[model samples]
Target: MRLTLSNFVNYTSFMKFHYSILCILITFISYSQSVFDQDQVIEKTMSQRWELDDEDKNGTFKLTFYKPIFVLPARWSSNPNELPQSESLENSFTEVQNYDQVEAKFQLSLKTKLIQSFLFGHGDIWLGFTQLANWQVYNDPVSRPFRELNYEPELIVNFPMKVNLFGIDLRMAGLAFNHQSNGRDLPRSRSWNRIMFHAAFEKDNFQLYLKPWIRIESSDKDDNPAISEYIGRMEANAIYNKNKHSIYVIGKNSLDFDKNRGSLEINYLYSVKSNLRLHFQAFTGYGETLIDYNHKQTTLGIGISFIDW
Candidate 1:
C-alpha cells in the first residue's frame, strides 16, 4: 500500500513476467488450433467465389431462387429490319416496317442446380432458364404491347478445378446443351439450339469465361435459319470486380474472318447492397434478341441486377 521504490520495482517485474507467459500460451494455442483445422483452412482457400456450386461443400439439391442474372431496361432498335419472310405467309404482312424508335427492353434470368455430384464426384448438373422481353411501354400506337419474348433453357455439367494456367487459376469447366426460342407462330417464330463447352479462369479480382458452341443444325425445324450467321459460334465473357463495382464485357464472333460478323455487350454494375446492384448496359452489333437476330443495332440501358459472373 505504501509507495516504496523497492516494492514498486518488484511488483512491476512480476506483472511483466505474467504478461510474457500469457502471450506464450496464446501463441501455442493458436498454432495448435491452426494445425488441427488444416483441412478446413485449405477448403476455404480453394473455394471459388464465382463458381455456381461446389458439390463437395454444398450437398445434393440447393435451390437459388429469384436470382436476377441479367436485368436491364434499354432503348432498343427503332428500325427493326430483317423480318422473317415465309412463303406460307402473306408477303405483305412480312414486309419490314419501322418499329417504335425507342422502345423499352428488359431481361429476367434465373437458374438452379437440380442435381449435384452426378458423375466422378466432382461434376455437377444444373438447369438455367432466362427470358428477355421487349416492351413498347411508351408507344401509344402499339398500346404498350410486349414486342418479343426470347426464352432460353440450358442444361449444364460443371466441373471445378484448381489448375494454374498462364498465371491465372482455371476454376471451372463444363459442357452444356442450350436452346433459345421466341415463342411465336408463323413468320415471327425464331429458335435455335447449341452444344456449348465453357471454361472459367480467374486472376485476382478478375474472372473470365470462354464458351464455344456448335450449332445443332435442324433443317426442317429451323425457325431462324440465318441466326448463326450473326449471333456467332463462340462467346467470351470477362468480369472485373473492384471498389464495389463490377465491369463486364461479353463478345461473340462467327469466326468467319472474311465476313467479320459478331456482337459485343458491355455492363457496369455498382453494388448498392449485399444482394442488389445497379446495372448499366450497352450493346452493339447483331443478335440482341431473337427477332433482332440478323438486325444490327446499338442500345443502352440501366436497371437492377441481382447476380454477377
Candidate 2:
C-alpha cells in the first residue's frame, strides 16, 4: 500500500502527503548565530524511482528499486524528514529496470520554491524518504535473491553556509529507522546515524563539492552490516548558460570500491519561460559495483520544473 504523509511546520503552514495525519508541529525558531542577512533561493525537487518489475514475495530472482526520495528543503519548513506531497506538487518518478546481475533507474527530477529562502544561512534543513532495492547474497553457482533492506524514512539537516572560493560549506544529518528483512516473515528495522563534513567551492560555471560521509548503522541483534563505515563522495557540476538556454553536467564518484558505486551525467537545464523548463540529458557510468559491468544510459526529454515560490 502507498503510505500517506503530512507537513509539520507552523510558522508558515501547508499540508502534503498522508503518512502522518496530526502533524509534526515544529515552529521556526530564529537562530541568533545565523550566518546570513538575506534569504537564499530555496531549491527543492519532488522525484520518484520507477522500475520495470516488482520483487518476488518468496525468495527468487526478483527485481526492485531503492528508495524514491522527496527532497523538500527547509525554507519550506524547520523540521527534518517532513517532506510532504500530494497529487498536485509533482508527478516526477524515475523509471526502473531490474536484471539478474544489473539494474537501471531513470530519474525525472522536479523542483519548486514553496518558501522563500532567507539570505546568508537560512533554510538549511531538509527532509526526504527512501526504500532500499532488493539486494541479495548468493554464494552458489546459480544466483538467487535474498532480502537486504526493504524501506525506511530518511531525515536530513543541512546547514547551507555562504558559498565562497577556497572555503567549504559543512552539512550533516542522520538517517534513522529504515526497514530490513530478517529470514522470517516479519521485518527487522535499523537506523543509521551519520554526520558528514563537506567542502564546497564554485568558480565561473563549475561547482565542486566534496563530502566525507560517515555511517553508523545500528543492529537489531548485532549482525555484520551494523558497524560504522566511512565513505568518500566527490561531486562536480558544470553549467553553461547562453541567454535563456543552459547546460548542466555532473559527475559523482564514491571511493567505496565495494557495494556503493556512482555515476556521471551531462544534461541541459533551461528556462523556456517564467514557468517552463526544458531538460535533456544522457549519462554513462557504473552501478552497485564500479568497473565490473558498465552502467549505460541515453535519454532525451523535456519537462517543467520549479514553478511555485
Candidate 3:
C-alpha cells in the first residue's frame, strides 16, 4: 500500500474518537466503584481508621489506634482459674496463686504504617502492638500484683479496595502475622503464633471485621497445643455507632462442631466528652488472656474508653 495524506488524516480521526470513548469509560467506572462517602458515618469512620481514601494527609508513619484502649476499675469474674496451666505438662503450675474474684483490667493498642504502596501500588504494610493486663489491685493480702499480662504484636499487609455485596461495602482486606505471649518465665510462660486473614466491611452505622487464622507450628515445646480448641480458629467483631452511643460485639469460634469452644464479649460506650467515653463490658467463655487460654469464665466490667471517637 502507498501512503497518502488523505488516508493518514482519516485514520488519525478514527483513533482519536476511540480514545475519547475509552477515557469516558474509565472515569465512569472509577466514580461508580467508589465506596467512601464523607457523609456516611460508617464509611467515614473506616476511611479515617485505615487511612484508606487519603482522609488523613499526615505521613503513614504516624501511630494510630489499632484496637480500643480502655481501663476497667472493677472487673468481676464468675470463675477464676486458681491453677493456671498449659497443655505442655512442664508448663503447668503445681501451686495455686492467690487471686481476687474482682480486679482491675486494661488494654493498650497502637499501630503504625511502615511502608505505603509496596508489593502492589495500593498495598500498605503496618506494625501493631497491643497489651492487655489483669490487675489484682484490690487484693490487699496478696499485696497488689499484676495477675496476667498478654502481649500481642502484628505485621499486616493491607490492601484497600471497593466492593459491594447486598448493601454492605467491603472496604479492605489484609494478611497478618500475629504473635501473642505472656512474658513470664518457666511454668507461667505462654505464647502462640499465627498467620491470619482479615476483612473489613461496613453498612449504615455498623462496621464488621472478620479474621481467620492458622497456627504456626514450631519445633520447640508447644506451650498451648490445644489453644485453637479453646481460644478459637476465627474471630468476628462488630461495631455500631449512633450519635454519642456505641456498641461493640466480639465473638470467636473454634470451628469444630464436635468440640466447640469460643468466647463472646460485649462493650457499650457513651461519649461523655472529647474522646472520652464511659465503657461497660461483659465477656464469657475461654481465652480471656494468654494465661487463661483454656479456662472458661464470665466477667463483667465498668470502665472508661479513650480515643477512636
- Give the top-scoring candidate (TM-score): 3
TM-score of every candidate relative to the true structure: 0.76, 0.37, 0.84
* Top-lDDT candidate index: 3
RMSD of 3: 23.5
TM-score of 3: 0.84
Per-residue CA lDDT of model 2 for 55-104, tens digit only, reads 21122122222221111111110121112111222311133212233222
lDDT of 1: 0.70
At residue 149, candidate 1 shows an lDDT of 91
Candidate 3, residues 1-309: lDDT per residue as tens digits? 777998798679668755874585455334423532323322247877887876553457898778987878799999987898887988899998888899989888999999887775788899999999998877857776788899999999999878998989999999999999999987988999999999999887899999999999877988889999999999999998887788999999999999999999999988765446688999999999988999999999997776442
> Can you rank all candidates by lDDT, best first?
3, 1, 2
Candidate 1 Cα RMSD (Å): 20.1
Which 10-residue window of candidate 1 scores lowest in summed lDDT? 37-46
Stretches of model 2 off by over 4 angstroms after superposition = 1-124, 128-154, 160-194, 202-206, 218-232, 239-242, 256-261, 288-309
**Where is model 3 more than 4 Å wrong at Cα?**
1-44
